[model samples]
Target: MQTIMYGIPNCDTIKKAKKWLDDNNIPFLFHDYRKDGLDSNLISQLYQTLSWDELLNKRSTSYRALTDQQKESLNEKSASLLFIEFPTLIKRPLVIHQGVAIIGFNQKNYQTFFAV
Candidate 1:
């Protein structure tokens, strides 16, 4: 199966998820959005599966620090653009395995999806 992992390299959650995949011998392509940056098309697909509410990390300073107008002007296209511009604004460790996109990594979900 072709699997792709997207997240910042130094994120603790992403570290744990990557370790889990490594330990389970699951082969995956790691896309460090913070470094390599985000793919807008992929981000759009994620927006379809999970709402912008779940995809955008409102907790991040990037999101919180946006001006009220910037926040209000964030439509689907703008949201995706913002995420590509600010990868940290998106949730961590978004795993794409066998065409299925997993937003946040959970042990049980990972186990079931990867068949570990």
Candidate 2:
């Protein structure tokens, strides 16, 4: 399968990930969830590789902006809805490589993950 990185274009981490891919000559496709909109099938695929704790960007301003009630009630189903409604709430660059989802970018991890 083709490598696909999902995140907003302006995100610093996304920028770094893209640069690393380009520098290593690793071909990939960037999916701007902010523009393209997230779908349940994609969300499910991500969940297959990682759990809610791993996928949720709790530190994100978009997530912090949620009402206390929303935060308190978060579960896989509810969180999925929130993620769909707010793409920024999900972790940056949920990279799908070889049918696995890598939640974030790290140089060493990328090297190993991509086997570069």
The global C-alpha lDDT for each of the candidates, from Candidate 1 onward, is 0.83, 0.90
Off by over 4 Å in 1: 39-51
Question: What TM-scores do the predictions have?
Answer: 0.85, 0.93
Candidate 1's residue-wise lDDT over 1-116, tens digit each? 67888889988899999999999998899998867756877777676667776788888889998889989898777888888788888888888887777877799989988787
User: RMSD per prediction, one decimal?
Assistant: 2.0, 1.1
What does candidate 2's lDDT look like per residue over 1-116, in tens digits? 89999999999999999999999999999999968768898788778888877888999998889999999998999988888899989898889998887878899999999999
Candidate 2: where is the Cα deviation over 4 Å? none
Q: Which 10 residues in a row give candidate 2 its minimum summed lDDT?
A: 45-54
